[model samples]
Target chain A: MRWLNTRTITPLLFMAPVLVFAIVFFFLPVGFSLYISFHKWDSLSPPEFYGFTNYVYLLSKDPQFYRTLVNTFVFAGGTIAIGIPLALVVAYSFSQSRFQTVWRSIYWLPMITNIVAVAFIWKFVLNDAYGMLNRGLALVGLPGPGWLTNPSLSMFSVIMVFVWMQLGHNMLLVSAGLQSIDDTYYEAARIDGAHSGNIFWDITLPLLKPTILFLLITNFITGISYFALMMVLTEGGPAGSTNVTSLYMYNMAFSDLRLGRASAAAYILFALIFIVTLIQLRLFRRGGVEAHN
Target chain B: MADAGGIVRSRTLGSRALTVLKYTLLTIGAIVMVAPFLDMFFGALRTVPERLARPPVYFPQTPQWDNFAQVFREMPMLQWGINSLITTLSVTVLQVTSSAMAGYALAKFEFFGRMTAFRFVLGAQMFPFFLFIIPMFFILRYFPLVGGNDIFGKGGMGLLNSYLAIILPFAVSWHGVFLMRQFMMAVPSELLDAARMDGAGEFRIFFTIVLPLVTPGLATLAIFVFVYQWNEVIWTMTVTRTAPNLQTVPVGIYLLRGAYVEEAKMSVQQAAIFLSILPVMIAFLFLQRFYVRGLTAGGVKG
Candidate 1:
């Protein structure tokens, strides 16, 4: 009885380091962020309590805020929409193919490469004066627009980079899901004269729902937090057209030192992501619990 | 026999068409993924005149293996690599250990505040760290401790611009903890019960028994943490601006890009970028099995 009771203490002892670190660094910051959201603080001056002022201005008066919010959604939505399907097709192909190993490694190369480095290389490729894209376009007698520098194309440019970075991981996930499907089901479908497309629609998509939903939720969360690439590729503008919520928050906190407003903006983003993730988790029942060791 | 031969011929045509479409799509994807890298490699090798030419050199006639040496001479390339390795490995090791222990607790033990603690970890993963940059910077630069300072802890720079500054704040990752816990949960409860019957202490049960069982999961998290910490730039840029010696590889390459003045220095920048990412590229090649196993196994459990 005494030994059984003592086991509890040992687990707590082991967990104490991580617990303390999380409390001080992770949880404390989150709580502090919430508190800071209500104050009017720049680094130079002490924070003054200004309840709801930052939130109000952000909602009603801030023009750039709305644009950033829309851009964040568009960027996330566009990347996810394109990324998920392409991942599905590629994963399906690789699942049924012999060269899966070689293909998987090639595709995953971009994801592990430094985003800043990737963005820099792509910047050279997207340069208006002598970019490869333009050169190729000229050969085809088509005009190449300013990819990164132009406001119209900049968001798309960033999204394309995101999609490229993410494709490998997502495709692998989808392929893993495909591998889990029993071959017998596919054989039976074939015996029933079900075409490949029909079999995929009926069996594969429905069966892969959990995996797909997992990708969606994680991608949405990761996509909104995509400031790393933006910093290198566009710095959020020819104008602020390419600024996502994360970049906007970064600029507010660091560049402008509007710590109070930045904290408010961060909380708002947290709230949005939390609610959406909650809904998806309930609907899809994916990624709510840990799935390892 | 003739009718059967015709049916076989039609099926062959169908399969060939499918293969064609597949290759076409893959070719397009391959181009998108490989083109930028090809550009980087070719640009680094090109002469200054070739780079500045009206139509830039798409393909260098000769690959300049010497550009890497030139990059090494221009910047503290080896120093940056060493710094990056130190920072990344320090963080990764600490994170894996802490995550494993906490994960074991979450998985096996029935403690008070367990669900609440787990939820807090989950929620923390969603709150982007970008929001904390300015405040976190001030705290890192001004935190009170052993260093001599006023009561408010604002005088001496405590952790700022040191390797500790880069590593400590990010060492505790909620996602890693969550990942470990999920992996631990998949281990059979009977194993723990048997260890208890064998008079094993809780620490022995966790370290000797559970830890070994979760080796594959730990490897996955290790790879993720290694690659992520390797590529990180923003926090490194913000915290260690003064200490060139403390700068990680990504930040070093970024600084070189910003500071390059000579027209010919562009190739060096390209070479620096290439060399900076070379370790990770090589790691990807060699660690393919561990990486895939980690992702798939980790995916299912989490």
Candidate 2:
């Protein structure tokens, strides 16, 4: 009836923005990206279809592509390997610590600060000769390594800075995860005369598995795709040691103006992220089930 | 008394040690998190010669507070600040309004293809932003009729070099929509039905009743978007490359890397960084509870 028509039209009216966003933001961009991936063209010229060429080139021929991929994995792995555990430990201690608000507010500082500022802050702090870190090392009569400039340690410096920036954020999430855990489990463990170490291993770790997995997958995705820090800090220099796929893709598209191959690189990186996420989901199905709840 | 005190101390020794260790780690961790910010603040106040000195002066002996005011003198910081404020505010407003409307429709309406729409939002979030940057750049460059483009979206820079370029891409946040739906679900159907019984229109019901009830949720989403958009650089930096007029604080500071390369201007750069990051810090200090609430509630993406 007329009433039913009004209801249908009203909902549709409300959904106008969503429809527009879907078309312009999601569907069109994705469709255009896919189309560009299969063809070769600069923005100046009409695209020419050359099936599988870009993909094939990136996978088999492009010297930098595979290297960037490896760098990305290492970056992701390094961020998660270092960031998560440190966050977990800090979070556990935070749950019991005095001055809860002060500690949290301090830790939460970096999470809110822009990544550009974060990178620049570390750029100064980690400077080889005039840096706070190196100066402190010199005070203790320790050798100060070239953190940002060195070819070997560029990625390591990037990871450590990222870890520092992310520590607060990860700690907050893990602390929440730590909070979700029922206290009765700890009570029961203590009743059985369990030592602190045993309680941590047997109860806390098992219960905390779900949160840890969530952090791992999320941080891994962020780590691999992230390049702004490296972009600002080293510009993927020191013999491309810090260059990840995302950064490489950014440069390919913007700097080199190879939109076609850049689109292909984006797809490849997306696929890698997608595949790894699926594998993670499958691997942590049991813990993940709890995570969703 | 001595024996009693000794017995009490012995009984509590392990627990006391654990507490001390926990506090110690937390204090050190807190310091590590905040020390860089202190370095930036101190560096901002140091004189040019102090910064350029061998093994550079760690502390500012006289503390050239002029550097803070000099950031404005050195760059178009006021314009950058304005641009940052405008774009972030516009995106936050657009995202929150659209999210509320769409989220309300999806949650409350029993329309055809509702599930598909909701599922589309969920699925779309999976496609990372990196995938769209190149195509989206061309799409905007070729966008019809704006920025002097003709009907076919040709012969112009399209949306480039405009405030729209920075604001348009972020106008609709899928996560905001999803989070809003979760918030709207908390609104009882009875309230809306009662309003309907009183002959109130759907929009009226949403505006007057539903909107007020979800103020907390709206605040949460606003904080998320404000923080995220205020800090968003990659896309903004990409689009605003040639459009220095449209660049935000982060992009301006970052792209102006050349200005800071000199030793004399180094302190000025640090001062600029300090100024740029202050607003968000202030906002966070005020609204931190929202962040904790939002993150824990839905595991909201930061």
lDDT of 2 by residue, B1-302 (tens): 56857755664786788778888899888888888999999999999888778767888999999998898998999999999999999999999999999999998989999999998877677778889899888888999999999999998899988999889999998888888888999999998989999999878888999999999999999998999999999999999999899999999999998867887788889989988889998888898888777777656222
DockQ of predictions, in order shown: 0.53, 0.60
| Best-fitting candidate, scored by lDDT | 2
Candidate 2 chain A least-lDDT 10 residues: A284-293
Model 1 interface CAPRI class: medium
Clash list (residue pairs), candidate 1: A290-B302, A291-B301, A291-B302, A292-B182, A292-B183, A292-B301, A292-B302, A293-B183
- Clashing pairs for model 2 are none
Residues A1-293, model 2: lDDT tens digits: 76567689888888899789889988999999999999988888899997999999999999999999999999999999999989989998998777788888899889889988998899888988878888889989999999988999989999999998899889988888777788999899877767677888898888788788888988988887888888888899889999999899999989888888999999999998899888887867856443332
Q: How do the residues B36-96 of candidate 1 rate in per-residue lDDT, one tens digit apiece?
A: 8888888889877777776766787777778889988878988999999999999989989
On the 0 to 100 scale, the lDDT of residue B168 in model 2 is 92
Instruction: Name model 1 segments beyond 4 Å from true.
Output: A1-5, A285-293, B1-9, B146-151, B186-199, B261-263, B298-302
